[model samples]
Target chain A: MPYRFLEDVAIADVAFEAEGRTLPEVFEASALALTEVMVDLDGLSPVLSREITLTAEDLETLLFRWLAELIYLKDSACLLFCRFQIAIREGTEWELQATVWGEGIDYGKLPLKLDVKAVTYHLFVIEQIPAGWRARVVLDI
Target chain B: MEAKKIAEGIWEVPRTAKEGMLVPARIYATDKLFKEMDQGVFEQVTNVACLPGIQKYAICMPDGHWGYGFPIGGVAAMDTKTGVISPGGIGFDINCGMRLIRTNLIEAEVKPKLRDLIDRLFHAVPCGVGTKGFLKLKEDEFREIMVQGAQGIIRRGYGWPEDAERMEDAGRIPGADPAKVSPKATSRGIHQLGTLGSGNHYLEIQVVYPGNVYDADAAKAMGIDRDFQVVVMFHCGSRGFGHQVGTDYLDLFGPAMKRYGITIRDRELACAPFASPEGQDYFKAMVCAANSAFANRQMVTHRIREVFSDVFKRDARDLGLDIVYDVTHNIAKIERYQVNGEEKELLVHRKGATRSFPPGHPELAERYRATGQPVIIGGSMETGSYLLIGTAKAMEESFGSTCHGSGRTMSRTAAKKKVHGRDLLQRMEQKGIYVRAASFAGVAEEAGMAYKDISDVVEAVETLGISKKVVRLQPIGNIKG
Candidate 1:
């Protein structure tokens, strides 16, 4: 599974765990987990695309900024992204470039169930497990 | 971490409870309330006490729960000269606050029209996830609001000038430099004025229940003269504008911590010295968010007045829709408090806690100086809320702060799993409470069982003499986002 909801992690917020074999795949799964909190991902259509690029000092901060950028797009651009194509590179600094695909929300057809306010660092973890790379994030809803 | 009872409703976690704790941690809670608290609260509270230049003790209210760095309902004051300021201390939704509006009409007069009133109010205020607001301001106009706060909207005919007097900080805090706010935050906030953001934000129609008025004179001063008198209460904050400000600062402060030589237990508790350039910049930006929230609430209040007039077929003024008070729950303010019998200036951060200034405090407006600042506590949709007044004891003990609301006891996902939204709706209907939410899952997540009892929390504060109850207002109808 790309992502699974983690129960009982927060009193008023929601938590989820995402995994992939590579850093970019984990980033994609994390992005999908975020949108799934707002709406049913299966019902969403990727009708448009927007490119995004973010750089951070480390992989963890990179993930934080990546998720925050997606939330900002939803709030300012009024778009709900369902698919994420991410590429990560580590050199002098950690950098992420991605193209997110989604459509303007049709409220009548795909009503939002929750408003994920911000991705929090509480108990956030990213590591390489035996099976693959895994990341856990808690969202302030 | 362990706590020992220090007083009737107080518990103390000694400085030795954790390494590097500069001060002891205190919590105001009954045994029952303490049992319901999460273990993370113990860790977070102690971590707050470990911050540099922390004065006295790090305190948590009766409704304290687990949060990112500071536990929700946490209160801490730091020395302005040497202490550090953390963006996490004030939540992402900066100045997330409460405003209570009182009406002359009573419950009996409103029962027949409750449905129409709630429906009209719901449509009047834009809510829910990914929702835009009514006002789309130009860059200059948005910056004006960031600087001027509610005064900007009041000048535009959104509210009366007198309304500003009843608001905390007169609806504006000084030192709000619009230039300190990032362009991205401004864009997110431009079209979000007068909007109610989702997740625990709501507009509720309530009635002062019979025999629930604890202080008749105080109640009367708040425009609650008779039993079952109608009122409206809203819980919201600065929206995406505030969130972006926090996000930007957290990124800035996290790296600045190493430069300041501050060792923090949690990454979320990132900070810089108060006198440092980075710290001063964050404070200025925070004030901008706080002021913007004041304006946001003022605009919403104006929309509510318009909706009431339309539903009652009378002018809003004639309907007697007036603001009782507006109080911010999440914010940091510079205030003077007595430390070691000498008055000193300190930066007070109250996250998920409300300021409850006692009677005769300089902060109270002329009309409310004798009655004390009104402390509004919102309950769950199924339970009732309270109207409280600040007390002098709170000034001495908690720096004039008290519990914000009934804190969550269960996780949102757990609540959703336990209660079906349709079933919760039916249960509320049977209890004569009308709830309108954008999504059924939203209702399920906020089910009454998910939170602790407001009465228990209020009783603890009352027993501690931090705040006094004036009236109990039960919800008749609610609009949730």
Candidate 2:
């Protein structure tokens, strides 16, 4: 299923396992779904630009931390992202590079719907489907 | 997720249920409300059961939730002789609570002027994050407010004298040593007294509906009166002062607990032995937070009277805004309760539970002895709220406590993801009550759907005979933080 809002939680349908793919593709799909929660990719012009790179233990922790930091940016900067080109460098830890962009927050209008107070321990992966990975998150607003 | 009856109207969490548990857990809820618990909530609550110095049981009222450390609806009493006090048990926002201010006027004269009165309150009262309050105090003055609690403010004449008398612990918790508080905590508190901080905190205008009791004459004596009866209800807490205390203490206790040999199941559950210096310090600081909260609400009461006087075109004396009661949500205190029919002096930590002391309890104020401690549970700004009195069953069954409010059912993120802020505003307006908020995100995050049915939560406690309904108040207007 494509990324969409469910109840009050944000959910996504993506192909984590596309018949045999590298770890990078799966990681990229998760980021795509996460950014979808903050801003509308189709409408986001990417007029602004920046780079976020992280080195972490392995694939899963790296993705989790990336999503968390991404959320932090959404909260602190009010900027969302779209369209990612990714590559992974493996050494002691995994390395990540990506571009994140969005427009300035208009305080006059309340565009931000929820206040994600914190990412909770309730996060978990159900399983990998033929298309990709499907996950559910209940943020503390 | 559902509650299993360990006894009649008393539920128990068997010791063998979960790992890392130091003690069992207990719950008090009606069969209907018991069913609302999801599996995750049960697990989290049981996790709290495993903490050190957790004397009797990790307990919860009907309104439980998945939260940082202890479940939002959790209640635990640790033995002072060998117990621990955890910040997670008290939560980040210390003493977040509700206060009720009553008036001398009946429904007829004030109901017509309610809107104008609310507008005045909305403008006069400071709300939302970073919103400054009416009274400004310096660092030393803030320290005084910390020690005296609401009395410090009332002595300065911000609110009525009756406010301190009617509130829990007389508008201040004893043993609050302001000296234990940090400079940062004092700085944060200087400007926040009497301010309504955000997140479910609100000042609501209400009319007293029938107590739904048969004795009409008796109801009047109890302040229930009749239909269309008007009143005002607000919920708030110690602002930056309380937040800072919790933050500072959590930092203080994080390492102190290890020194005291306290092993927590989670980092957030760090605790110190009750007899230890760290424990004593946290208690003293917590009292300061509780007092600050009492003063914060008292200041709002002062503003309410001022607004009502202006709107009604009458002298302030003519418009009575009496203090019903004010109770804390996130604080730990030392109290005595019966364990196996023997009195035990224990530190009863009520994170989200209200102290529902029955009429006979000696801790109650003189005036409330006949009616018991009034339990003010404020629902969402849009739906409504409730006024209840304590039952002896609550004291004997669940550490002399009951549910606080409608616990959050869905996260703000999920709620925001589902409902548009603009649309939510329209829906609330159509309901006949007007809401003025600080930010659009504030309103969306606090939408009524974010919480469970308060009526259900109340019904659980009532059916179990822990708390009895005294009156049901529907909102007329509200000022959100």
Candidate 3:
């Protein structure tokens, strides 16, 4: 697993830390951690796909926006994803493009856990370490 | 870094406790409760005291715990002329509140049909993640509900005509401009009405035991007359709509602070001057989310009524399904308060703290003038919740506020690690609580041991004279989202 849940970070909300050797890997790891907080990934089937493209001023904001986009889609379209193919390109600004595959949420078939409300900037971190990229996020559930 | 015990159930951290602090910080808790508070509560509350235009004190209730930028039970009253409005202070769930509905039936009559009733409610009122509401509204109608709140839904035949009066602000605050809300927020929340979102959100059937009623007159005034009278209480908020509103403003306020030349210790405490354009825009938008929350609870109330009508084979009204009170614990409002012997308007931000307006206050509805506003403090499903009444002391000291709940003392991950969902289910059943949860993992995460004792939090507020204990309601059946 690329991401692990933090035991004592947020008392009422879910907090996790993710790591990867590349920006895309880290983003994918963080995305999976967030989705895992809501529902089991194994229970989801890749019958539907949605493409998202977002740009932010920095890597941290880009990660925040990416997670927020996943939450927004969950509410707006009743969609949840189990797989992510992410690409992060940093030019003048940080841009993220991803194609996430999942299916429409069926309450009867899926085991839904916590509802990830919003991604908070509290203790939010995204940076490149000497070995790889690491990101920490606290999600409002 | 030091907090001195100022009085019984009260602790104060001087302005010298932290740099850039303009006012002192006060925490309302017993010595026991205070000891359990994490270091984050002190750090965040002190950080709030340093914000520009803060007045008197930055107060944390007995249920206070570490939150994003502000403590969960944080309350800060700011000078309206110079103070700033921060989205972090109000929380992501705008107007996340509690609604308590009364019923004439007693426990004996309801015991046999409890499981059937709860199951029906579970099916009727959609819960859990990615659950859409039953009501499908056009974009315009959604906007109307944003502005009109419970009144709009009541007009649409979702509630009784008098239901609005039983709510704080009559379930609709004035000056909510739908135009201030973004399309993203609207789309995200348009289908979320009547939904009970997960994570500590629940719809429970509670009974007021004979010995639990502390103030008989107050309890009766709030419609708990019988010894074992039944009531329904649910905790939820504006859903994704409120989160989007908070998120949108947090993004804007972060940069807006730069234009205002404001610097803060924490980025999560991002704010803009209350009178500034950015602040006013957020305020109006926040009101829209607040009203949407009111409307959300209204639709949930209607669904509960429908389920009750079907299961019991009687009209909802005939079952005495009337609202006892609806109170929102999370919000920021510009209210007039006496500061320094002068009555001036202040922007009071209450995050995870209920507004405990005393009796005779002009804001309260006529029915509650004698008994004061009814304050509902929801507890963990395993523990009992409380009903308290506002007091004059709260108005004079804490800016009309009190604790919101038995705040969490343990992290969700730790809780899930300690309590297995299946075991907790069996344990709760043995304790006479029948729970239907959408996710067993969620149940483990919300185990009773993870939170502070409801009685302790209630005692602190009661001892401080902020609110008087009226009654305690025990949950008999619960539907967890």
Candidate 4:
């Protein structure tokens, strides 16, 4: 999903399906799907990079927290992730290690418009597909 | 995309003879505000106007920003007899709203311990994405939590029942049916109660700015006694539970759209007739989610009280850590109003906007009936926020709604480019505040400069007479999820 503009009236469950050659591309597509809920993302180039990390109880929690972290980075922090890497560490709980990159804040510099207020857990689930991992996250804009 | 003025601050967007349109779209904004409108706002709002049962108009407030089905500052009323309700209108966060608690703790008193207190609050209340609570529940109990809402939180002794009295509609919408909620939504919602989900959701400590009073007596009664009385403001919602509800309904409605003989203007605006079985189920489910959010906030307030009492070594009640008011910025509600000089019942939707019923309006809760409902506007940490009440013009123009926060002016990516999250944190701390965020970049993107000036946004609503200003609060300590 490269952030599409829908012409249909499909409220409630937002199905986000994307394919990329790498993990970063898939995550990038997922971010686009989230941003697409509020506005167009094609024109929204990478504006800045902000590092984010969320410690959770397990891999499941880590994946969910990862998206929520992205939303906060966008809405409250005003930074967007164009690149990302997720590393899982087995410890007391689970540590989600991530390195995110993007541009700086200058509304004037970006042509994109939309806000990902929060990451929602409505039908929000993450699992592995044959080729890659698939995650569904609902954003509260 | 040109915004042509139809009247003073009123812009008309006639239905473009689109196949799905039921009514025209209208926006209330000055030329200056129009210039600031997001490019997609026009398309999104126009799509809203095309809904099956949209009433006289699909209206957008001055603070309009791009949203799912409707713009963030959008207002629309569908006839219960003929119109439809989309979960998109209420948003996935459910009753994601703001609650302002005025305290006896003045700036001078808390300023010294602000660091310790914010850290305590941040720790006491679980925040960030996928954050669970200190309390967990079984399956059946979670269903009850959904239906009972804030009352459920109170039953657990999280807060006094009286706290519900200070909330809108006593913290529960009557029609909530927990059974209507999908099991998935239920499961996710269960552990999420009392937790603060990530993103713009946060708990902030604020100090009142000087000389901008609209109701001195009311402020005193609410316990914001000094110019810099420390007040707590936070934005959150039903979290995973709300998201599940929205997702479940969206899945339900996607296939059901074909039966309505309606051509949707946008996929996000999917809706079913309010009178139909599908629509009824969605509404019931949405109510359950709404109630869950109400309870979530109620429970958080309880946590705040506990943390404040522990940190300050005083009873929170004695300190007046009482709720001034709580309002839902994103929710669909049934309200009565005058349209074309005739009284009609409407399903008014306020997304990214708070209900601001004027003083003396019978619709307000008894506590707010005489003074009007408190409209809490949470701004960025660097900027100030406001406390306003509804006015006559609001009922007439916007279905009684006003802006919810300082609309985002910059994208997170852009903000991050300009400043490092770590550097921004240092700057914020130097300004005499404490900062707790899950991610440093998260804090950087939300730098105060990323949003519209609160003063300008609050003034737009007040100057238009939709809401009246009462108090101005400046952030002192904050947490971003």
Q: What is the DockQ of each candidate?
A: 0.74, 0.10, 0.84, 0.05
TM-score of chain B of each: 0.99, 0.95, 0.99, 0.97
Q: Is the docking of candidate 4 incorrect, acceptable, medium or high quality?
A: incorrect
Candidate 3 lDDT, tens digit per residue, B1-481?
7999999999999999888999999999999999999888999999999999998899999999999988899999988899999999999999999999999999999999999999999988888997889899999999999899999999999999899999999999998989989999999999989999999999999999989999999999999999899999999999999999998888888779989999998788999999999999999999999999999999999999999889889999999999999999999998888888999899999999999999999999998998999999999999989999999999998999999999999999999889999899999999888999999999998899999999999999999999999999999999988
Q: What's the true lDDT of residue B282 in model 4?
A: 85
Listed in order, each prediction's TM-score against the native is 0.99, 0.79, 0.99, 0.80
For residue A14, model 3's alpha carbon misses the true position, in angstroms, by 0.8
**The candidate that achieves the highest lDDT relative to the unseen native structure:** 3
**Could you give me the TM-score of model 1 versus the true structure?**
0.99
Q: What is the C-alpha lDDT profile of model 2 across B1-481, one tens digit per residue?
A: 3345876455777778876778777766666556655455577678788876676678877777666567778898888888888877887567888887666666577667656776788778866534567787877787777788889989998876766778888987778888898776776567767777666677888776554343344345445655766677888777766766765676567558658776766555767888889888888888888888888888888888888887877876666566777888777878888887788888888878898889878998887887788888888767788888888988777788889998877765566677876788778778777777765666777787777788888888888788888777788677876
Supply candidate 2's per-residue lDDT for B254. 58
DockQ of predicted model 1: 0.74
Return the candidate ranking by DockQ, descending.
3, 1, 2, 4
lDDT of 1 by residue, A68-109 (tens): 998888788888898888889999999999898998867788
Global lDDT of each model? 0.90, 0.69, 0.93, 0.73
Off by over 4 Å in 1: none
Give me the displacement of residue A60 in model 2, in angstroms.
Answer: 18
Candidate 3 vs candidate 4, DockQ winner: 3
Q: What TM-score number comes out for model 4? A: 0.80
Candidate that beats the other on TM-score, 2 or 4, i.e. the better one:
4
Q: Write the per-residue lDDT of candidate 2 for residues A1-141, one digit (tens) a residue.
A: 243344422210111211114455655555555544433446555567668898776554465556655554553344566655667788988888876655554434323322222233233343456665554333322
